[model samples]
Target: MERCNHGTIMRVYRTRQLWGSGDDTFGRLFWSFGPSIHAFSRTVRPLILIDGTHLRGKYKGILLAATTLDGDGGLFPLAFAVVENENFDSWLWFILLLRQRVMPVDKNNNEFTISSDRMKGLLRAVAEALPGSYHSYYIRHLNANLLKTFKSQKLCKLFSRAAYALRESDHKEAMELIKAKNEKAEKWISEIPKENWANVHFKGARWNVLTTNAAECFNNVLKGARELPTAALVDHTRWKVQDFFHFRRKAEATWKTHLTHRAEKWLDRSCSFGSKFLPRTCSWNEYEVLSSTHTDSADLEKKTCTCGLFQTMGLPCGHAIAAMGLNKLDRYKYCQDWFLASTYRSTYEEVIHPTLDRTQWPEPSYDLLVLLPP
Candidate 1:
């Protein structure tokens, strides 16, 4: 009990008083344990990456977390908080703890970077809480969202190009770089706020690499655990958090890693960038992805061919990838319109991870993004 509560139980049982310190028992444990854990991690390196993992025990809750990477291809779990939901308030608590750990005095501490998805509301809260801290979104989430949102193979190639720019250098140059190749996303300029595309000056390069991909990855780790009870779930969550760092350790040994990515670089961003769902209908001659410029060819403009693969069969047509590549494109980008990101993995997984994968999934193509080339 002394070790568990930092002498609180002894002080309580002997003195018949709650506590003389400003912090409660739990607070004491948290501060002592938290700093020790943080200090140990700092010895390895100064990054304190964070994410909220879901619980699989009898308790149903979200696990908010902070972590760091070491020079020896290892991971150190820094701090964590548990919540029942993933809203602004809950996410704020997680962010606050993370900020407190990184910038103790709020001075120039280049020791850490924050990563997350391009989620607007939650990010806004993070900004308000910690001004001038680095915050980036995950490229995987952006790729997933773009693939899921654009839904058109023709537009996908262009979007991917822009995304590559955002993922590569300063996110601010996206339109400048890819706008000529794909004017379709120009409308996003007016839709998204300015800060979403802002950058942080890093070692001479102005850019960002922050996103919620870590949390999403953590969420995937928590898949089976989400249904568990609270205590059991939190216990497992702790174990999994440790396991994540362990895998991360191995992954680091195998590959270079930063505790966080480039997405979380800019703490301040404008809401100038926005999402647009408008489907396009460029003429087949203009639709470089098409094999031929013939409207009468129902299969081509209809996002299919006589092969009946893309639109009907649901899986990509060997012919589609072939046609798309002829114009320099990524085949997987087209899988999004098929309905959901959940669907594409079905085909890939229904045959792989049988324990985690499920079959009987829906076809990729359900409703067309637009009516026609009007």
Candidate 2:
């Protein structure tokens, strides 16, 4: 890492704990990001996905990741760390560095949302480090944990409904159903706060993501690099992320719609679904969208639907779509700026310039000892 850092302004920050009575270290952490990642951070969604994977090399360790979501609902790499383990201190260090170097926001203000699989120490670190942020757990992870104790598929399905239910009433219905079958299941989930896993109480746009799969996706991308030496591993990740940015930027240039491809597809699907229900207007903006089983309130002026998908996803729901059609309103106007192709392109516009050859590197101001596995 020292050799690579000499040639470029790209930053690589690390910390190590020294051992007593010997020239040895116990644990170390390596964190780095390229110019493109820093630039990309400005354009991607405010939601961050955090997770860790085990390294498969001679020196086993945890690969901590912090990733963002693109406008098209794709994984946007922000930063990474090779940490000794996924302990509370390690997570706190990584998150603090992320807030300081990458985000640079007030610790007491809610400007970002974090999604995770509810790792043991992560909850505590996030609360201490990012007091103002919203931390949502992956619902699938919670269900899997419950499955270990209660193996009933019925309980799992009810639990999923409770988590995925957009409306508060609907979520309550699912929870009640779970209580009827197994009071233990209900008690287990009751321990976790509603805002952390249930969509009905989520503070911000989750974009239909129920898991920390985006972070996992990036881990898979760096699977082979996990075995490389420290210096080589960093360079490998840099190149891989560079290629990703370049490819995504160029590929999206031909997109014609104002919204991203995924957003457009979602809108189109909603429009098709809307065609099935004829909305009855109660006022200029308010309408009652009726289905066979239930009716939803659609308020075009508020950009909301009682079904909750509209506000949750920042895209029109079927009820909202039906209401808009009844009012002869343009569907495209309802789309949020976050899902625009322009936003997607802006995220990858910056380039991650390659590192200079080793011979052209400058001398380090201070000597850095090479860290060996403990």
Candidate 3:
């Protein structure tokens, strides 16, 4: 695989047998494509969404995936592994490999925010493997659990509102509504750490992503491939990823703006809304944006706004846009580089070379060991 797809990282673990012609058996496997890893390191957001889906091949196991969102809000897969089961050890092994081979902490001490379901094993794995990183729970999963316990749609909706709320006050108001409706439900939500599910409390930027939907979307695309043999599964993923890169590369070439289509649309909406607000200059970089409803403080120097959307979404909020317009500053300059078209181009710049036929492969110098499925 490495020879075919240069720079690919693949590892296989074997378990020793206690009896009978003692031969090692397949224990686990992990792989990350060269292009995918390079793309993520160069351009994608630091947030990773992880999830596991059961495989239905002859040797039944679980397929674990680590995915991220690209600059254009598209799903970009980083790494994948197949394990016998979803346990603490298995999850820990995968995460460790992910850190070492895919997203190692550099001299700058870059950290990532990992989002997944509240599985006991995965939670423990992330804590042990990435102590410095922020971990978040999927709000959809949390809401589902809340619904299962309370059997109330209204409570679930309120819980979602609290999780999605951008400001502390808004989040507090949503919680109070929940408390007024059902004290037990409010208590149940309070038990889980706010940083794990609430947007206002999370220490890291989530890019407004609240769920493992990106990973799920990749899994759905691999639905049929999940039934293939181990080798075939890996090959299928490679081809699919290659196609994704090619398609996106062509699509990006047609873009005329400095930002992605999604980013441009978001900025346009904010700009239109901001036009209705009046900006009162407090300083060269600070301004008070006033509207009929409320007043918001926007600091162009800090790239922040009192509305909370600026820092949270990594994009200019309506208030910030209004402030930028007042100073005649380029609104695109205030946007994060992750949304830049240049970054998107760099992500898909590398070509994913196709693998040669197996029959033409060279023999290994070392003796081949007979292996059995776990």
Candidate 4:
């Protein structure tokens, strides 16, 4: 597979019985496609969502996946592995392979974020394998736990409000509401670090994704394939991913806007809201945007606004939009390249080559080992 796909990375680990007297058994398997790796490195956001699902094959195991969002906010599977189970060792091994092969920190020291459910040993594995990367807890999972513990719908709603708050003051206010209703619920939430769950406190750019829904959604798409045997499952995944790339590659040509549909919608909403605000010039690139309730300072040169949304989301906030309009600046120029149609096209530029039929397969050049399943 690696020979056919230039940059593909595939590894299979072998193990022996306790007595050490038989053929080697499969311990784990990891594979990442060449085109997916290239696309992720070149166009996709740095954020990754990792999750594991139980496989229902004859030999039961776990399917661990790392997925990301595309320019149009679509789920993009990056890498995946099959392990005996979802434990510390399995998670660590998978994460180590992901960090080393798929997304190593580059020379510029660019960091990325990983979002996951509070799975067994996952947090510890990420901390050990990729210490510098930011780890985020899925808010939906946290909310489910809170509901299971307290059985309060009101508290769950309040907790969601706190987790999704875009500003520190809004988060604090939501937390206060939770505390006023249930002090124990507040304490339960306080135990987890704010940065892991709260958007306002996160240190990395999550691109407004607060959950592992992307990974879970991909798993759902592979629901039937999980029942197949190990090798079949891998091939099914490849075919599905190939379809994803082919479909998106053709679809992008039909898009009319410079940015993606989602990004353009967000920009249009910002523009509409910004039309209500008046901009007063502070200097060549600075302005004070005033609304009926408050005023925000926007620096067009810095691509920042006092409202905080501009810098965090890589899109102009209402204040920034107001300032840009006052100065007759191009709104699309301020948007990030990751959301552009050109970048989206580049992501699917390469085709995922299909595997040949088994009857037409070439013989191996090296000695092949016949391995057994564990």
Worst ten in a row by lDDT for model 4: 103-112
Which of 1 and 4 is the better model by TM-score? 4
Error of 1 at 34 (Å): 4.2
Candidate 2 per-residue C-alpha lDDT over 1-374 given as tens digits, one digit per residue, 9 for 90 to 100: 43443222233433334223444443655455545345444566677788899988887788888887787887777777777778898899888877776774433337688889878789999999889888889877888888988998888888988889988888999999999999988999899989888998888667667876788889889988888876687788878877887888888988999899989999999988888986998998899999876798988888888888898888899999998876588887887766888877777776666778788888778997664445
TM-score per prediction, in order, is 0.46, 0.87, 0.96, 0.95
Q: Residue-wise lDDT of candidate 3 within 1-374, one digit each (tens)?
A: 78877779999877653223445888788999998888777788888899999999899999999999988899999999999899998999999998898984461223688889977599999999888888989988998899999999999999999998988889999999999999999999999999888999988877779977898999999999989989899999999999999999999999999899999999999999999999999999899999898789988889888888999888999999988886688999899888999999999998888888878889999998766878
In the range 247-320, model 1's lDDT, one tens digit per residue, is 54344344322212111111001001101111123444222232332221123345543423344323334445
CA error at residue 196 for candidate 2, angstroms: 0.9
Better of 1 and 3 by lDDT: 3
- Residue pairs of candidate 3 with colliding backbone atoms: none
> Which runs in model 2 stand beyond 4 Å of their true positions?
1-27, 30-41, 104-108, 280-288, 365-374
Q: Top model by TM-score, which number?
A: 3
lDDT of 3: 0.89
How far in Å is the alpha carbon of 45 misplaced in model 3? 1.1
By lDDT, the best candidate is 3
lDDT of each: 0.40, 0.78, 0.89, 0.88
Against the hidden true structure, what lDDT does model 1 obtain?
A: 0.40
Candidate 2, run of 10 with poorest lDDT: 5-14
lDDT, ranked from best to worst: 3, 4, 2, 1
Per-residue accuracy of model 4 over 241-299 as CA lDDT, tens digit each: 99999999889889999999889999999999999999999999899999998788999
Q: Higher-TM-score candidate among 1 and 3?
A: 3
